[model samples]
Target chain A: MKKLLATILILSLVLTMAVGCTSDKVEETKSLKVTSGLWSRPEEQQFIREEILPGFEEEFNVKVELEVIDNIEKVMEAQKASDEWTTDVVMTHSGTMPLYIANEYVQPLDSVKDSLDITFMDAFESATTQDGKTYYLPISADVYLLIANQKALPYLPDGADVTKLTWEEYKDWAINIADAEGAKVSFPLMPIKASQYQVGGIGLSYGSEFPMINSPGMLSAWELLGEMVKNNAILETSFNYDNPVEQMKSEEAWLTFYHMVPVGDIYSSAPAKYVVAAAPAGPNGNGSIAGAWGVGITAGTNNKDVAEEFIKYLARPEVLYEVAAGTGGFIPPVNEVIAQLGEEPKDIIMKKGLDTLENGVVSGVPASEYTDWGAVKSVFDTVFQEMWDNDGELAKDFLDAQQKELEKLEK
Target chain B: MKNKYKKWFPYFLLTPALLYYVLFWIRPVLRAFFESMTDYDGSFSLMFFSKVINESMFTAALRNSLLFALISVMLQFTVAFMMALLLNKKFKGSNLLLFVALIPMAVPPAAVAILWKTGFSTFGWINNLLITLNLIKEPILWMTAKGYNALLFLILIDTWTVLPSVMIILLAGLQNLNKEYEEAGLIFGASRFQIIKDIIMPILKPTIITAVILRMIAAMQVWMISVMMFGYGRVPFLVERIAYYTDMVPMLKESYKMSLTYSVVVTTIVMISVMIYLRVNKKKEKEVRI
Candidate 1:
């Protein structure tokens, strides 16, 4: 009986192992093959079927399957692993474009640049290149601006300039408003680490010649933030990037520095309730970092010509306007598109967005500014959180250490 | 002739499994060890291992990973043991409770991550309830805080997800225990707790050790929960570092080396846990024989 039991166990184990291996192999074989990758917002999936895909199919005369991978690193890794190029086109942030370029996973667009009439080609070219090779084209731009709750308009000093406030002036205004209305006017303490390019805004406000964290401007910026914290102008808890508009609508904060997307949505919902204006100018100048997304063709694509055409179509002014307006909150990257917007319905928020992009210090940092900036941010965020929560005094020390660590990447 | 045929039949049945172990398991382990020693820049070199060891995140990650594994496993085992003991008793709706307890196991890790993230947010349900009860004036940023709080949250979430599986295993062991041995101790005037401590626990010791070791090994390799809770380098777990290096760095050789080092460390911990279990089990067996 014992022998029989042992034999049965051995047979079952063999059967299970064989079945598992075979099933994995089968699934691998059956996956849909694609030459180009596509990424879009979850809401745009249906729209892609109705609008984007039909045109691409008709233009290319080839049926292409879309591979939707969310994480940026995974998309890069997937391209590396697969022998035959799977993604022909990829949509990614401007920050990640350098890694793709350095690894030679993205091909230059010079070959097809002459064939297409791209309205924003010059503007897009300036921001998306490394060493004279254009690897990506801009799809949309997002600018940061100051949004105010109309209820707090009465508290503002009669002659105070909202557009150009020194650090001291902005802090004093925030404190006065906070004292009058509890928790009503606050800056979001939670920094968005994923958007590394936004760091340029902080550097810009600090009067730094370069976007260096160790500069005196950065120290001044930190001191300004510390003063704000002491005055209760910043929230104790970190606020979500998407929730500030809701907070504004509910009268939580009178004024905040926020992206154009959420603020524009709030204004459209209740036009009379909120006013959006240009981000307050710093000691050096009125400047904010310009964040953008771009589309690039994957290197070694079988359908490179068709993919290039799609990119060209995406860069046209009309297409840019359609995507910008249809998306409902995004700012158009093209200068001509912004000029044409003068004919549209006038609003404080739309005008602020146009002015912010036009006047702000556009981020020129190469995508490869730091190799492990994510790692550095993760560590810095921990220190920042501690300082905010416990009133710790390690911000300068932490910044110094981070600068040392970042210097290693230069080697 | 019939005897020879039967002997060969068993060998034929076992051949596939033996081959599989050699090809998939043993070969990869050997390759990983060699790769760990080399500066594997896409290919192979011996200097890569030195580079990984020299990096500061390596040591930090190792320490964090150990702490996470130890704390999570101990908590999981204790909770699972208590639940298993409670379930071993006969009661109405006991089976229903067991079914309900398994719900966490059925939920995907990604979905559970999202749930924890929402529940632990600043203005989440937990904070809202706390404020309503006058427990605190403001929302506590549970997941965003550094050091102990973030680590504690991760462990709690992990324990919640894994405890049910551990409980089920211990419950089966309890059911299979010899009731006569316990009854005899009771007849001898031993108290309930005494009988449990002296007879039941000694017998259940092997099963408990097995479950703890399995859970420890699993916890040591934690990546998804850490990444979902705190992005790369924020929590600084070893596997998170490995993944970040692999994903973000252009140097594939260094990434492979780091991965190999992580695999070695995790494997070593698991082996040590198994060794402890074997040593304890041997001593117990010897004592019983005496």
Candidate 2:
């Protein structure tokens, strides 16, 4: 009788301990779901999973469920319509923050802002802030930079510096390249993978306000593009080109103005084979489309505290620097992280990008002010197509009609 | 009681399918229709429709889509029917030929685009082959094709991709056909061409209609190849424009309504096209009866 009683007591004790352990495990394995459209390449995703998230997961006693998706905006839009939100943190392009802010899809990051010790660039900070409220924390900044194949160095127009070429000199360089070889200058003109920002950036250099269709600077930019097309100075395949990395590797395109990450990708592979420079200057100054990626917490997230902590973690100098370095050497927006970058090939390229932002007239994405930035991009596409089809003719009447269309969209 | 149960049994069996269609198909269609008409403020409006019509690429998209559908369907059907007829003959290596012909069907649209893109590139294998054959001194710039030439290029690529599926359908119809009909035409002093035209064609009308309708709908939705081949504005199609609005710029406040409106427009066009085809075919059938 005593043995039976002791067995039952011991079994109950083990059962209680098992229940306790299960509860502890459940408490310890709290998950933070982060969905980001940035750094979504397989290698980048792998780095985030293997290198970046582990420390946070271990430190916070939370499992980081990182989802790298290209259509994060669509996902957030759907989440806005729902009563429940699954995503705790969203990392996407800085331009998309306004859409979320306008719809109240994301909560203010005051806690994160207060906690961060590092200084974010003023431009990046302003991009994510509106009406005295911070919507997002800018993680990294990117600019369009000029990447030239070393083979094309000889074709540089007389007395033109490759790093500081004016718009006319740039055009002359392209013509010279085309004259020497076939048309080798390229742009990422592929639909959806467009370089309207390049056009807009050039407009800035020409002293035109961006998203303004009919300005004199814009006309000059368009006319320059037309002249290049007329001379067959642009790659014939540029209409279908997206990232010119592969083309640059193949020597199919010798010179291009492209996003810095891709320029980093090519230069890092064979730094000696290519040259990275600031975007060409015009009358205004060197013009650049300054863009950045940012992270924010969803308004409807159940894990607000954890999400805030995660944002704080992301904003840490070490984490940001590692993320920037791992993800194709993006320029970290934080000053401290920028200070830590070494003299690596990609770092050199990124430093050049920073030099452009500092020296050049930088233009923010049209989405910062325009609600229908897509429509704005479409107008650019149509006008550019017309220009290309017409052998680079600057169709002023056509530009005026499109400008009216742009104005209508604003209303 | 048994008779009533029997009467209800088919409907009882169909309940799941009915519910599936109502939930999945009908609901989304209705939702799209309503959403397209509604403004951002949830007020009823025709602004989205008008906006889509007035959109810059709308005309190009519509014209390209229609032109692609009309030309591709007719072209695909003619070529597919000819190939099907040829394969229907009991010749040596016929099965091997069919297998080889069906190989393209195995390739997905995106892969097909890549294959053709590589071939059509300036210094691609096609140019190299031409050079090797001494047919040309320099490479022909194939990717520089603009406007209609671009459209034609897409049509040819699409035809190569979808021909096998269309051919297989017609071939199945030919295989099921009675041998006695062709024998009768032969005995009646008909030429091979006359036999095909008079005896075989009438019997193959149902299959031809099926093949053409399927091809027509698929052709109407031809955007991926064009996109993969030439990107967006270079060769805009109705579905491509829809993709541009939704997939390309889903963040834009106007994108949601614009995509839905484009969807409605495309659906309407597809429905009307099929109706006209059926109506014309029915009229021909009535004439034959008379």
Give the winner by DockQ: 2
Q: What lDDT does candidate 1 reach at residue A252?
A: 47
Any idea what lDDT model 2 has? 0.87
Q: What fraction of the true interface contacts does model 2 reproduce? A: 0.53
Residues A265-377 of candidate 1: C-alpha lDDT, one tens digit per residue: 66667777776677666766655766677778777776676677677767777766766655445666666666667433233455676676677555544444655544444
Best by TM-score: 2
Q: Give lDDT tens digits, candidate 2, residues A1-411.
A: 999999999999999998887774455478889998888667788988999999999999999899888677668878888767999999878776777787888899986798778888887766688899998999888898998999999998789888878989989999998988989987778765556787988899999987777899999999888889999998878877777876787788999988888888888889888888998999999998888999999989999989998989889998888888777878888888788777888788778988998889998775646646666787787787788879999668899999997787673
Clashing pairs in 2: A226-A392
Second chain TM-score, each model: 0.90, 0.97
User: Which CAPRI level is candidate 1?
Assistant: incorrect
How high a TM-score does candidate 1 get?
0.78
Quote the B-chain TM-score, candidate 1.
0.90
lDDT of 1 by residue, B124-174 (tens): 678888999999997776755677777888889999999998999899999
